[model samples]
Target: MSGHSKWHNIQAKKGKVDAKRGKIFTKIGKEIVVAVKNGGPSEDTNAKLRDVVAKAKAANMPNDNIQRAIKKAAGELNSVNYETIVYEGYGPEGTAVIVECLTDNKNRTAGNVRYAFSKQGGNMGSTGCVGFMFQSKGEIVIEKTDSTDEDELMMLALDTGAEDFAAEEEVFVVTTAPEDFGKVREALSESGIEFLEAGVKMIPDTYTEIDEETAVKFQKMLDVLEDDEDVQEVYHNAEFPEGWEG
Candidate 1:
């Protein structure tokens, strides 16, 4: 399960670098707008805004874009209201899948998501149909650099209220309670620690290994959902074959 998680994280980062940087920035920008609108433009006084800002930074979103989003949300510029929606489904071979979306038009987003699932031999399910298979937690990944000491980092994370720590081959994974995420991340940042990825994610309890053919179908479904503008995050339990590039 850890290995699969590591592989998925690496692929996600590579996907951002290879083709999805702009889309990622746009998504994070929307998140910033939502955060600012729900709270205020000032991160200092808005805890949600602070968390969004941290997420933006982790995604390498430009400071200018972040500020612009906040201004827009605060009415300094044009803004559009967005709503959060979550869809639960089963992928090929009955692997549990969950997609999180933010959109102004729920009808369009719902159609797109459902099509993505059905086109790849899967089907969208009712809310909570597959949600019970996963847990929501704050996850942080840090690269293993020459200066990174596993023991020291583990101690720091534990001392800073991290719930769990795992040292993977090329990265360190820190798990924290959802509410404690910001506090732990801030403390780690204050100590000059950098994160490759950090966000609240839905983690599956167990993984389901699939054949190559099923993996291809699953990957196609994932790609379709990920390429949708309204989609923010996609989580699943399907594990592909060793060294599967898809």
Candidate 2:
């Protein structure tokens, strides 16, 4: 599917293993709190909170940690106000990139993001600079199984309002319009389908291929931003060379 480009970030992070597990939990926790504050605490009644829970589960976050975060978010004394910010920029070789953050301090987040881009030989741009190069959509990834039928899965996904489906070697990826994401995901869940990852993401229309040297630089930029505590997600249009193992 067109949105598969975002998977590059996930694949790259796998190389780092558990080193960032705590930071990952922190980011997801902030998202859960924001979701709770925006809607309510009940996942059954709050669609966004439900998706955040699914995301937390996908990350292998501990049940106790998840329950703690939910309780804190729903408590009356929870006063932290997080703001969602999207930063657009261009990486090495003109590759488009977008960084999404949730932070209580906008100035701190902006400075951190700007430093990452500049330090990596890239430049931060205006709000819509690189945003127009990608489409916002919902992406759901399911690990492939022995009984997975491509045709059957495609039919089921489309019937449930999915926009597109692709069966990769290890996973089946489904794309849906932002508005239909929740409904489609619910339908799939009811059918006993398990998702490896699911979220609304920015998908590039086309990928920019860079040489080996530029790929290294591009990845460093991603790593710097991803390591930031306020940064939640990073999307880029860069495509690493085939067989060039991360």
Please, what is the TM-score per model?
Answer: 0.94, 0.93
Name the candidate that leads on TM-score. 1
lDDT of each: 0.84, 0.84
List ranges where model 1 is wrong by over 4 Å.
1-10, 13-16, 76-79
lDDT for predicted candidate 2 compared with the true structure: 0.84
Residue 222 miss distance in model 1 (angstroms): 1.0
Model number with the top lDDT: 2
True-structure Cα RMSD, model 2: 1.9
lDDT of predicted model 1:
0.84
